[model samples]
Target: MSALPTTATHEPEAPIISAVKSNASAENRVHGLKLAILLGSLTLVTFLSLLDTSIIGTAIPHITSEFHSLPDVGWYVGAYTLGAATLQPLSGKLYAYFPTKAVFMGFVFFFELGSLICGVAQSSTMLIIGRAVAGMGVSGIFNGAITVLSAAVGNEKSPLYFGIVLGTSQMGIVCGPLIGGALTEHASWRWCFYLNLPAGGLAVLILAFIHFPELAQKKTFSMALVRKVVPELDLIGFLLFVPPSVMFLLALQFGSGNTHAWNSATVVGLLVGSGVLAVIFILWERRMGDRAMLPGSLVKQRMVWVSCTYGMCNGCCMMIASNWMPTFFQAVKGEGPTLSGVHILPSILSQLSAVIVSGALISKLGYYLPWALGGGIIMAIGNGLVSTFTATTSVGQWIGYQIVVGAGRGAGLQAPLVAVQNAVKPSQVPIATAFLVFLQNFGVSIGIVLSNVAFTQTLTQAIPLYAPSVSSQAALDAGAGAGAVRDLVRGHEDELSGVLRAYSEGLRNIFYFLVGMSCIAVVLSLGMGWVDVRKKKDSTKSTGDNEAQEKKVEEKSLNEA
Candidate 1:
């Protein structure tokens, strides 16, 4: 709860440094072919970074079977998420202190290394480790891409570049399951990891040739500078934030099943430990002030906190739906993995389409709140309808329901970021943006864990009640996968009917949970203040002068950082 930092530093060199950067930036502005190449590389990296998050979902059953470790299903996704969340904040600091181009390529190399590990992993443990490493690499890609793009183009063109990258990454999310399914079915599941190699290599190669503008001060590295840069990176905040996050997510992942019950000592201990660590984290952040992961200075703003909360909810909806939809279709509808992925396209396409439309509308109207509220309502309705799905649910019903939720999600997903960015000073935008992205990704990790618990718990209880002859342990052993369930009940008509019904009900329970999440988003969206994106009407002279001033201020801030 410390007051936010003011732009009132007393450093003697600040003004001189700012003036030098202002002049140099104009000279280094990128254009033409070089600009296009930078954007294309950024778009590719963004796509691959996000692609890993959802691609594993369709292949989870295959991974589970190969390792004979059904209980470790959630870890496949959560492990990668843990790494991403842990390193997310630090990446922002790293960019501030190091050469952006070198740092970005280094992270990409790390990502590729991870994918290689996963592709060659012989055990479930190895795969999880690979995922964690890959997640660490992905953690930096999005932030780095944004920073590079912002520097590559002027303010007027930045939004369009960001939109193109965002849309492409989203399409990657939609295509992940399809790609995972195709690989797992026709090729080896390992191909999913190998797939990243060539595409990522091409991106890195392009980045190697394209130079981006960087603060001149960061080019020099010395032992003397280490002391100065270390505090700015805020390693203490990172250490405090990561443990509690890991504990909380692990507690949820282990909250059910034969080995770990809700009230078991392991679960109870982790829950209590997570709470204690969270309290410590808050205290630590309060002390760190501007250096905190969720910096107290920027977070004190109302828009910042509201946007963070909104991000958490949005992340939950996005990750849960993306990860679970393929599983649901295969299990309840008896579709193959490839076909199952295809079945969910209506929703993904609509969400992407809505995002495009939403951006245009918000740009014109200048207010994002209406879209946010409207999206929440529509999402809630969609989830409610989806909660009624059963084995007999028609194709039209599922597709229509998905379209509704997809549209809702797309409409409001970026609004919170817009609100926060507009509310902050130019200097605070980087940290503010990083903090929001961290919360959103953290929400994704939490959502996947919660969904796993709910789905497993429901299926565990319902399978026994619906089919008294089938053991709950038997169904549990089959895994939370359509193929697994089919294998278990194959040639047993009555058992198949009961197990399918149980699976359907379990999926419904998850949708119902999302309904509540969507409703909460609506309430949070209402709390967002009315901020217009449109430029205020002013005399031409004043408008030009203000633009010039703002540009200098932003560039100076970037240089100082």
Candidate 2:
């Protein structure tokens, strides 16, 4: 009656969190103080990297003031996403094939470099470039954090650890707006980026003292090794992947409703070129087979597809809302950047709480599907409710809507990763993790561009009806920041209210799209299948039998001695 295969994917092994690894003895494990520092540093790295993504959200108004470009909002906001998405597969493979600690530290160097660049950047384009570099490092760090954490605490307990780490680091991401706002208002917008340098530097310093799982089996990076490493990293495959990806995302950024007409040469040409490149990539990957950056066999798995889709949908809903919510507070509510960031805290805190609780529930119950399924339904309701928000929306209504939306997003954020990790072999886990991360970034990138498209398209029509004296372009320009909006309608109260309502309508359309994506996520989540993580590897060892395990370990250690 069920499609579940009993013997293939689910290989039996004794649960090993409290037991010796099947590969190495108990002595190889790092515990106590050193372990705490390792995990804390890893979480810190993650926090700083993710903080960059949102820290700029509230600071954007300040940023736009200096740059004077509003249409490039997607460029500034998603530049890091572009880098994160592009480097994902390679980042995963690097962790898989190289020494983990060394590669992680290397990524930290590059991430810090990007932060330094952003702090000193003079133009919007330069800032976007810096963000892209930082994003590249974030990609490796994300994959490495998961891989390294799993090795530290066996796969059996990884879900809980991941929850702890993600829950902790996510604080940086959601709170970035608050921190960025304060810094932007009091100090300078550059402080938002400058903040990462010292914090990330300290995290790297702590990491240098620790040992990693991959280091125990280190290989010299000789010329012969380079020959193997090049192919292993799938340099050619990524070369093909990068161009088409950039083309596709750029097309979305300039999509008809946002910048150019559907029939315009620029949009049409980019779409066609991107499609052709994508086809070539698929064909080349097919030829490369297992050696490809995206292996066909792994990519073809039902669970893998479902997980990637689910991750994409979850990211799409969450990221688009995050980007727009701050704008709502500033534009319609006429709040300062600091107050806007404060108002957005409900969503952030609720999302974090949901992730921590949901992760614990999944670990205890050994089921991720129910959370994924339920989260979608709740998220759909949340997004739909949020879509109803308007200029006159009350404080209670906004906060309540955000909490609901955040709960739904946080509940399902990592379900796909948990599901994929369970479905694949340990060796293939890095690849799967990379794939999931890629799709999540991809979804986020496209969602952000499209949200802008939806917002801009609605504003174009609404501005004419709402404020007859104001040109559509001028009103659109006014939305570059709240200051601009106030300046544009300073003389007329009626025009001000009209512009505010236009903003509400424009943001509403974005939520409508999110509602549809949430429903699709619900459908995709259903196909992740059902597997009890505990039963899959429950064998001779069980944490429930702790006394027996201690005695067995003691005897084994004595025998070796």
Candidate 3:
């Protein structure tokens, strides 16, 4: 990868030039009203960006119904994460070379554009494209928000600003289901995507007024700059990374379906070619060594490996069944979208509460390992119980089961980050964080696909046995929507019971997959050696060390990227 270009820092003499604002002392990054405005806008942007991750959960059934694309269910959820995971590294580099404000605004524009496309999507393919585009934008939105915030503020007050941002992110996650449900039920599902426009516009408008701090070094754009930027972005590595991954994903999408047998030539060829390409990619990265997108020296570290793997496992545990939670209510229980959202509130709220409580406790006690280990075990138990849920399961049992799963997830989701952060030196924090974050998203995408495969295969068989008279494909065509499957066997109590039973079997398989994921998480957590965050040196010494690290980071421009 090439280095970011350098020149004496100054705004270009152009209309689009950024109005450079200088940062203040660590005591107060920005004072009074200006700081308030910046933080508020950043918080809103953070909320808007993270909101998309969860908002679509409640709306998925509606989307599938409208598009009548049961086979594409995984794509709807996974496309965003796939885009985000692949583009994630490049976003940080873009910020390094490009104007911060311009890059940030460009990301917001992409996000809005995507939302508009999704709002008016005519088919499953269009919706997936919109989701992918939005995910691409989201890959940078949160990072850009932080970068802009970092420029506006100083080091000392960083925690407070980040707290606000993170808190808002939590709010976005919890609120997404209800908002999507309400919109899907009362308004139109399209309204769910449309709503992002006004909110995101407000955030963008607010941000335009805040002149960001100038970089220590920057240069004007030119042909030479583009050449330099390409190398810095690791274009070859990115190219190698995306194609094989897509092929592998395609294999998963078609391999277990009725449309394609597991041993079909297309599936086999994709699998074999993907493996060869993956091997080539690894070899090229090894040859590139430090220049690789995933630098060999860094990845070889035990903690980095553990953090990424552990995080991926935790992510799998969380996402494998989450997309189907609403489907359970809507399809199995005959609940409306709005009521289904209401029903899922227990999981969301419990997870949120657990996150807060665990964060406080972990900070106070100074040990994250116990929480990480215990969380996986609890999540495994929760997933097992969840898999046991049937069409006739009682309300309290389902709610309590969801609570257990949520609590388990909340308790451990942040633990891997701590492991990664503590394991790296200050200068390496950015790269480490980026790697973990990418793997987390990668995990979500893969887990969702796995869920889809298991559900598809299970339901394909179950449908034939239960609704023997009704065709399997036609039943699946019902799109897992409320009463859609039941509608197929209307007035036939035994058939309705059998059909619902088939759905319950498939959905249960998804949750059972999650149980295995949680167990893997447990093993990974065991591999993460204990580290106490509270055991730091004296404040003055720590500050001096941080200054030294900052100097190293300044010398290495890629660190900033």
Candidate 4:
């Protein structure tokens, strides 16, 4: 087996000449234009995958009402997330075995098919299944984009491209809720899913015309060398890992409210089962070495571990804010869902600005550590300020605080990826990037569960305190049933105002917990080593030269002996 091409051997400016020398420059220009088109198309595909998550969140209430179940509603989100998480590790395997273009294009088809199914879903179960399928497709799309982008630009330019790709994806997330809300209000909630069809179709058309040399040819895996060069897909790992993750998520979504208690046997059983399965899976992976779904040695690296942790923490904070802010506006601030979605505009804009500015600055300055630290601090402060939110708080105040939080999140989001990519050997970049994303998604799931638990507990306690005269039965009825509490308050506006105040206070209390989480993330950000993205090309050149020199000395000494 021959070694892969290195940065030292690959020249960016090597020109290609066809039979006619007169047309060489024209050919090069055409090639550059095609490359730009390819990047744009791939970026759009990546954006679509991320857009689905946030876009659907704003429409959760509509879906729940149509399906007639709140308990099962979380699955609308969870199903997609579970499928994405389960398939993430396999992306690397698919990339290694198939043409990158084929793998990406195949996943896009799956994603489109799933979206079509979701748009016309007649029941909650069908929607959940559609979401899961979509997730399975999405799991590979963004990872494939990152892999292709890295290959296109080489390692020296990867950080800038990584930042650009990530920034674009985050923009999709920011736009999703607003777009979903507009479509759901003026058109139909179904259009939220239907909208992806045209966007995805256009992306497919664009990509077809844009050629990717890296994915132009497919490679076959040899059975004899498979165990040594690439580990077989760990079916057993999937079986063990997927169930526990699902069970754990189920327990979180269902073990609260009237369904089950925190200490109930069903909840306990699921929790314990998940823990045991996770332990067994880890042990199994340790024994398998290179064959593990998550290679232990790679994870043990300091940079990898810290990057995963930071990613998880950042994910948790972002998920909590994204999920709860709309609820807060609707429940306590007396804003309609559509209005609430609009209110988040400032946060979204700020996040977008931060992402673009951060990318450009990292590309120019080359240092990412200071930005990471500053971002963490901003996030903590923004969250802490939000803890003071009250029913009387003005929209301007709310949006301002949210923008601050958004800036913090945006600034910190890309730094870890840049740091981790810089730390590892080029061969490990795909796996490392996938692992970081996986951890972040895992964190989002965990955050939703924990925040849901906190909100439920706080509301339950506060409702009774503010509405002592209301019968326990009425309070319970209002708490468990949708629109019940809102109706109750509307009927007795004077008395329920106090109850609304209490609910707002309870929600604010949860923000305190979020602030604490951000602070912990701040401490962790300090541990991520510094790297200068601006000087990355020069640095890599020097390092490669030193390595080549060392190899030459060893060769000369061997010949003399």
Instruction: Rate residue 330 of model 1 by lDDT.
Output: 74
- Report per-prediction Cα RMSD to one decimal: 5.3, 6.5, 6.6, 7.4
Alpha-carbon TM-score of each model against the true structure:
0.90, 0.87, 0.90, 0.82
The segments of candidate 2 whose C-alpha lies over 4 angstroms from its true place after superposition are 1-33, 146-164, 208-216, 255-259, 539-561
**Candidate 2 vs candidate 4: which has greater TM-score?**
2
TM-score for candidate 4, residues paired by index: 0.82
lDDT of 3 by residue, 1-561 (tens): 344321123111211223323334354345679878878887887787777877788888878777777778888778888888888877877887777888888888888888899999999889989988888888888778777677667665667788888888779877888888999889998988899999989988988887765342456778876765666566788899888988887899887556788999999999999999999889777766655667677789997888688888887776655678988998899898888878888877888888888889988988888989998999999999999888899999999999999999889988988888888888677777888888888778878887998988888899889878767787767788876767778666578878888889999999888889889889888878887787742454788899999989888987567
**What is candidate 1's lDDT per residue for 247-348, written digit by digit as tens?**
887787777556688889999999999999999988877776665667777888888888788877877887788777877787777777788778878878
The segments of candidate 3 whose C-alpha lies over 4 angstroms from its true place after superposition are: 1-29, 491-493, 537-561
63 in model 3: Cα distance from truth in Å? 1.5
List clash counts for every candidate, in order: 0, 0, 2, 3
Over 4 Å off in model 1, which ranges? 1-24, 215-219, 535-561
Name the best candidate (by lDDT): 3
Q: Which ten residues in a row have the lowest lDDT in candidate 1?
A: 4-13
